[model samples]
Target: MRSNIDGKRLVDRIRKYYKADDFQVSDDGLSVGKDFYGLNKIKRVEVRQLGWRENAVNIVSLALVLSAATWAFVPQFGLIALALTFVIGFSCWRKYELRAEFIGTDETGDHWVAIARGCTKEEYSVFKEVERTMRNQV
Candidate 1:
């Protein structure tokens, strides 16, 4: 478990790292970028790993490319299909990301918000730290 001071510092670092407009930590609670969740109101903080299904475009591109392999006899059509699939697949892969969600309940009802999204190691560490800090508070 991290000390309160360490947690606060971590939050500050994360806010700066993400270039969040307004992420502040206080005695009562902490604000996540734009949304603030009181300590008492927070129910859960978790990191959701994006699955293959979530990247539907990537899936479709992969399928198209694989099926296009069977159309090897059709030179022009096969080349076109492969080229299109390559472009789509590359774009989809570049945009792919995993996200961290903050789940809390208030007067209305339970709701969740994405606190962070990225595909880098540093960003992933930030997600884990945020989850740990929020979990400890709750």
Candidate 2:
């Protein structure tokens, strides 16, 4: 179930986050100090892929190691398996690019709202409405 979020409390929490070096509220709005998704500006899919891709690197390394072992531990070609795994892993990582600006709050101040880099005015207006309601509640 979804519910409305409080504004003063939200601002206070954001302040605390900024204080904790977890985030910072700037002229631009709230900036979670890092690239962490829970910091409030990234998508679930992007975050999920970031987590999964790192995991894939490890899994791929394991598989390559197993393959090398099956090949009688030939040292020369053993490095090839490792090298290819890393190359593939790096390419996959590249496709998971995230634009940090998309994760920030608006000038009107609504945290936890996710808007893409290029937003339509209509979308911004709707977000402002949500912010207005939340602020009014507090």
Candidate 3:
């Protein structure tokens, strides 16, 4: 899982898509924004999909309450509430399902800054490649 990574090349590749000044790969570790994770301290690099299922109950409850409250006040506004609920639900679902996140976990916590979002399969492959390279470097 571990392989030596060319720090310069990796940094260049990342810079092609991410123009952030705070991100850099160094001999000591990877720097993303203000966070610095040591090469040996990074325990894992992974691509994770975040979904709304974890908050489904809360969303459903909110929708029901809003709809009921509006319906009690004005019948037409209830329709508006329903429409808003659908829009919010669809947006939340799409937001999580369509993008993949690249994360690096170290002793302190997880750092997400290696890739741009809205990641497709190709982007996912790139994330995996970065993960492999980082693992090897570790």
Strongest candidate by lDDT: 1
Model 2: per-residue lDDT, tens digit, 21-123?
Answer: 3333343343444533332333221111135555576558765766578457676676676676666544433212222323335575433333221123443
lDDT of 3 by residue, 1-138 (tens): 133467656644654332334346677876655666676655555555545673475467767888898999998889889778866654333211112133445565544443333224554455555556566666
Which is the leading candidate under TM-score?
Answer: 1
C-alpha RMSD by candidate, in order:
12.7, 16.2, 13.2
lDDT of 2 at 122: 41
Tens digits of per-residue lDDT, candidate 1, 58-111, equal 667695866578477676677667667766565443222323333434566666
In order, the Cα lDDT scores of the candidates are 0.59, 0.40, 0.54
Candidate 2: regions farther than 4 A off? 1-56, 59-63, 66-75, 94-138
- Of candidate 2, the 10-residue stretch with the lowest lDDT total is 41-50
Order the candidate numbers by lDDT, best to worst: 1, 3, 2
Best of the two (1, 2) by TM-score: 1
How far in Å is the alpha carbon of 124 misplaced in model 3?
A: 0.8
